[model samples]
Structures are given as C-alpha cells and as structure tokens.
Target: MPTLASTNAVEIDGLGKRFGATVALENVSLAIPPGELFGFIGPDGAGKTTLFRILVTLILPDQGRATVLGRDVTTDVWDLRRRVGYMPGRFSLYPDLSVEENLRFFASVFGASVEEHYDLIAPIYEQLAPFKDRPAGALSGGMKQKLALCCALVHRPEILFLDEPTTGVDAVSRREFWELLDRLKASGLTIVVSTPYMDEANRCGRVALIQRGRILAIDTPTRIAESFGRPLFAVRAGKRYPLLLAVREYANAGTVFPFGDALHYTDRRDGLMPDAIASGLRDYLRGRGFADVEVKLTAPTIEDSFMARMGEPERAA
Candidate 1:
C-alpha cells in the first residue's frame, strides 16, 4: 500500500485510452487520499465508467499508468483485484442464486468464509436478510443493489469502487445507501464512486468533473461552486421556450440554462441590480404573451454549477 505521506491511496498519472477513433479518457490524472470518499462526476457519455474500469484493472490504459494501494493496476492485476471491491454499474450477481448464496459464493472465492467477513457486510446485509432466500433476479432493484454491494465487500477490501451504485434504486434506497457509505467511511474505508448525479458530488470529500473523455475540473464541491463569479437569476413563466427567448434577447443576459423549475440566468451587467433584472424579464415575457411570469435572484446549486462549467459556448457562465 502507498505510504501515508508519500503516496495516494489511488494515483493515475498521464492516463489515456482510445477505442479506434473514439477517445475514452485523455491525460487524466488524479491522486486520491487514504480513507477519502472521492467522486467522479459527469454525464452518461462523459467517460466516468471508462475511468472506473481502468482504475479497477478491468481495462488497460494505452498511454499512462495508475497505482492503487501502491500496486500497479496493469502489472499487478491479481493483487489489485484482491485489494479492491468493485460494484459495477449493472448488477452481475447470479440470477439463480439466493441472496445468502450469492454472498457466500463471493466470500469463498476470496478464500474467506461468510462468517469471517460478516462484520464488513452486516450493515448492508441486514436490510437484505428478509429476502435472503429470494432469487437474485426476483429481488427489487434496491435490494439487488444492496446485495451486490454486500457481495463486493464480503472479502474485506482495502478500497471500494462503486460505479453509480444508486443509478436505478428508489429515492429511499439511495438515501440509505449513502448513509451506509458514510458509516463505512467513518470506519476508515476508502471509496471511489462515479455518478451522473451532481447533487451527490457534495457528499464526497472531493470531486473530479469529467466530460467528453477529458477532465474539466477537480476540487471540493464548495470550491467548484465558489469558482462561479457571476450574478444569477431564475426566470420562469407559463411557457419555457418564449421565456427562454426573452431572457436570451435581454441585453444583460450572460448565461441561460433550463433549470428544473426555471431558467437559470447570469449576466455581465455591473450596475444592474437584481430587481431591475427581474423587472426587465417580466416585461419581456409579458410582451411575448406569457402570463404568471416570475423571476427571482437565486444562488448557484451543484446542477447550476455543472451547467455553468460544461454547457456550450453561448450558454457558458
């Protein structure tokens, strides 16, 4: 394992990969500290999965190298596998096997019995105990995810790689999963989780933003959000298209994106106050034949931060 002060728990330097003409990851480099819950945040095609695969030794990198717990991912494949627990984006548990059987199977594969590592998986397993006899294929989405997580942890790994562990799970399940992760991290587990959920980025000790097979920014969530240096406004109306047009046509509009409830707007206006901007937006929407128009100054959120950082040139903040 990497020494405490000398090496990171996970390190990737000058990493690059390609699939024919498509570049999957490019010059990606990062150093994750011991016991840190690091997140790779991006969209579906943003190369999050590719990076995870390389780090866990599932795929080989073409240009650079990486080390996990001081073991090279490429050269020390077998050793790395024993040290890391990987829960891929999809559930890959045996469909015919029951939950308990699945857990026992994974434990035995590592030369350890279920009783030997029960403490490591007990928290997640408790939620799955009721369905222990149910076929893995018949379990609910959340239960299946929990089972997969438990199976990965059965051998007591030094690092856990969760690739969108909450992707298809219910809202309650997602909350519970994160809570369980917190408990495990409190016990000194190093976790690397990749997700398309920007909201989950803040829960991580640090986050790296990837897009189009390249890294955009990596920092604490607060630092990433604080980097946005513009006044923001949320503009809304009965119809979004015309409201968007009006906001875009507004002279002071700097950036505009469709946020969940409204269009988040930013501007380069120096002296234009929030009230003045709000007035201009309402008047323009009214002129465009939209009613019940509302506009308000709002703070930047993680989603807003992602849009501001990665959206197209015209919409960039």
Candidate 2:
C-alpha cells in the first residue's frame, strides 16, 4: 500500500472537519502502519466516528488531506472503498435478511463471493454458521456483533476500522469478541478500533485518549500508566465513602480518585508527603468503625493515566 511518506498504510496530517457550527475533528493527524492493530479510544462525541468517516471517504475534510493505501481519500474514494473494511458502531446489516443473506449481499456488493473469502472470515464465520438461517435481528448481541464483523471481513480489506465493536455486548461476549480480534491481528490484518472502556486500553498496542474533540495523550498502555509522576497509595476504611471524602480533602491531596474497592491518593506536587497522609488517614478511617482497613502504595491504571493526562496537555510528561 502507498502512504504519504511511504512508511504508513494510512496517513492523516493537519486534518480538520466540522458539522455546521460544531467542530467534529480539528487538526487531527495520525499514521497507522501496515498490518498494525491501532486503536482510537475515547468517550461519546470524541470525533472518532467523524475521523473514520473522513478516512473511509464517506465525508470530506474541509482542511488538510488523508490518504489510504496510497490513494487520496477525496479523489480515490472508489478505490479506497475496495481496499478498506468498516464496521460502524451501529448494526447496519439487513434486519430482514438472514445471517447468510446479509453476508452474501455485502459480498456481492463488492463484486466478491463468500466462497472466495471464506478463509478470510473463517475464524468469525465458524461461530456465526450455527445461526446462518436466523434473521439478522434475531441474533443475540454477541452473535450480531460477530455477524457484523464477518460481513466487514468478507472483502479481505487491507485496513479494518471498527468503531466501538464491543459496546453493549455481554461480558462473556465482549471477552470472546476480543479473542476473535486477537486472532485476526495475528493474521496480519491492520486494525484501528475505538472504544470508551479504559480497561480495554491495554489490549491495544497504542491508544489515543480523546475528550471534547481533543486528544489528551497517545502512548502504549504500559507507558501511559507508568507516566504517572506521583507515589500512589490505595486506602480503604470500613466505611469507604466517608473515607474517600476525607482523603480527597486532605491538604496533601495531589490526585485522589476511586479505584475498584479502594481509593487511590497521591501527595500534592508541592510539598505534601504520601507516607504522613497515609498514616494519618489510616487512623482517621479506623476511628470511624472501619475494619480490616488497608493503606499502601499501588500501581496506576489506564483510567488514572487518562484522567491525569486529560487534566494536562496532549504532550506527555
């Protein structure tokens, strides 16, 4: 595939787009290498969908340009469509059509046959075959997601764009879906997926945390977590809520945010000490009828790094 600089599968530089008065995407630039599993993670209204649309040629940018597989998105949309696969967040498969029918329809639309691409979608289609005769709308959330993915893969696209592929899926289904993605990545398919779940950040090779149409940070999940520049401690009292309030208001509070069952606290950047506050809060919480109370330093999570980076600029520390 030809890239703008000859080293990327898709390239976007100084890209800008808008929807009436609202800015959909602003100066967004990213390069995805060939056969890479890139992720574009963010919350609702984060311009993820907008950027995907622009890259896939569903919409054009007002400023800057984007090229996919070496073809300009604006001028070579027809060829780009043949080279890329997209699975929108919504289920766009034909509701009235059967599972096999939906798959065949999309395959024929691209002038390809399911038999020709069975190897490309075998991992996913195997699970979908049991319900091949069922109406598209009758499949469970997990089944529907798989069917959608199979439809997207039937064309053997060089670059796959999945927008929140696991949203609204059951826990088991979500895990299974990711497992399928891992196998697909192993097959040398370049993937770019977006999701709002912070825990899923680790699954991606690298992620771009976005909010309010701006990026907070872009780095490997481990690197992002390690970028936390403070000594973090997890504190839990028998009474958790009050304990959280107390720790958050403490004079030493640098960043106080809730973890799973415990609260994570860090000393202020200025002068507050973590050990002193931990010792003090340990006693303060126990005095309030807390049992088996625990306080100790802990590792930062993806959500922690996202919140911290969101509070700062796009540049990493």
Candidate 3:
C-alpha cells in the first residue's frame, strides 16, 4: 500500500487517448482535491467514461500524465489500484452470487473481511440488509447499484470513482444515491462521479462539462450557471416542433434549445432588457404563425451553460 503524500486525490495533465481513428479524449487536464465531490458532467459518448478508465489505471493514456493519490496511474498501477474504489457505469457484480457474497468477494480481494469493513459501508448497506441473501441478478436496478457501491467501499479506499451511477435508476433512487454520496463526502471521502444528467451537476461541489472528448468548462455548478452572460427566457407555444424551428429562425436568436416542455432561448441583443426580449420573442413567434405563445424571463441552469458552451467550435487540436 502507498502512503498518502498530498491533499490532491487525482491529477491529470494534457491527457489524450484514442481508439484507432476514433478520438476518445483530447488534451484533458484536471485536478481533484482530496475529500471533494467532483462531477464530470456530459452526455453519452462525451468521453467521461474514457477519462475515468484512464484515471483508474484500467487503460493507458496515449499522451500526458495522470496520478491518483500521488501515484502515477500507469507506472504505479498496482499500488494505485489498492487506494481507489471504482463503480463502473454498468452493474458488474457477479449475477449468480448473493449480495453478501459479492461484498465478501470484493473485500477478500483486498485481504479484508466484510465484517471488518462493515462500518465503512453501513450507511448504504443497511438498506440492502434485507436482500443480503438474494442473488445480485434478482435485485432491482437500484438495489444492484447499492450492492455495487457497497462492494466498491468494502476495502475503504481513499478516493472513489463512480461512472454514471444513477443512469438507469428511478428518479427517487437517483436522489437517494446522491444523498448517500453526500454522506460519504461528509465523512471525508473523495468522490469523482460522472453523469449525463445535468441536474445532478448541481449536487456536486465542482463540475467539469465535457463534450466530444474535450472539457468545455470546469467550475462549481453555481459558477457555471452564472457564466451564461446573457438574459434567458422560456418560450412555449401550441406546437413545440414548429415553435423550435421558428425560434431558431428568428433573426435576433442567440441560442434556442429544447428544454423539457419549453424552449430555452436567449436573444442576440444582450443590451435589451428582459421584458423587451420577451416582448420581441412573442411578436416573432406570433408572426411565424405561433398561437398562445408565451415567453418569460428565466434563470440559467447547468444545462443551459452546457448547451451554450457546446455551441462553440471545438478548440484547436
């Protein structure tokens, strides 16, 4: 086992990777502090998983360097593996094994016993106790996730990496899972969670928005939202499809994206007041055969920030 040498849990510099002709990651760099809840926010195929795989030492980077717990991910892989916990995007527990069996298996891999590390995972394991005897395959999606989390923490690692932990779980389960992570962070555990859901970004202490193998921005969710430097509005009308097209075609449109039940829009005329923008949007939509159209000033969200950032061209390679 390697001794901790610094407060930074993970560090990466100019990291890049590729699979044949397909680029997976490019010029990526980031540093996660010990005990911080850091989030990698991006949509599917955004290279979030590729980054986690490299950081956890499961794969090699084509360029640059990465360190976890002060140990190089490539050169010090053996020692690094012992100090971090990883729950991949998919549920990877042995299907034939009972929940208890899976937990025991992971613990044994680290030369530890479940009973010895039970306290470390108790908060999450307690909810799974009743299903201890059930085969992992028989459990619900949420239960399977919990079992994976317990298995990941059985050895009490210094840093944890969860790749889209709440992807397929229900809304309630997602909420509960984040609550569990919050508890873990409160106990001084460093966590790096990647999620395609923008809403989850707000739950993280800091977030990095990634797209097409590049990092768009890295900052707190609040700061990311605040960085949207323009007034925004939620616009809706009778038909969303036509409304979306009309909004995009408007001469003064800055950015128009579909945002669940409404279109999130901003005006190119940043100097205009919110009320003026709203009034202008209504007139534009109504002129384009939209009826009962409504446009109201709205606050920016992490999703808004992501859309705005992604609209820009990819940085020079």
Worst 10 residues of 1 by lDDT: 308-317
What TM-score, computed on C-alpha atoms, does each candidate reach? 0.91, 0.92, 0.94
Model 1 superposed RMSD (Cα): 2.7
Index of the highest-TM-score prediction: 3
List RMSD in Å for every model shown.
2.7, 2.8, 2.3
Higher-ranked by TM-score: 2 or 3 = 3
Q: Please say which candidate is ahead in lDDT: 1 or 3.
A: 3
Please give, for residues 177-277, the per-residue lDDT of candidate 2 as tens digits: 88888889999888889998888888888888777666667788898888887778888776677777777766556777878988887776545576776
Write one digit per residue (lDDT tens) for candidate 1, span 84-123.
9999998899999998999999999999898998888898
Query: Model 3 reaches what TM-score against the true structure?
Result: 0.94
**lDDT (CA) per prediction:** 0.86, 0.84, 0.92
What TM-score quantifies how close candidate 2 is to the native fold?
A: 0.92
Report residue 184 deviation for candidate 1 (angstroms). Answer: 1.0
lDDT of 2 at 186: 91
CA lDDT, candidate 1, residue 95: 93
Ranking by TM-score: 3, 2, 1
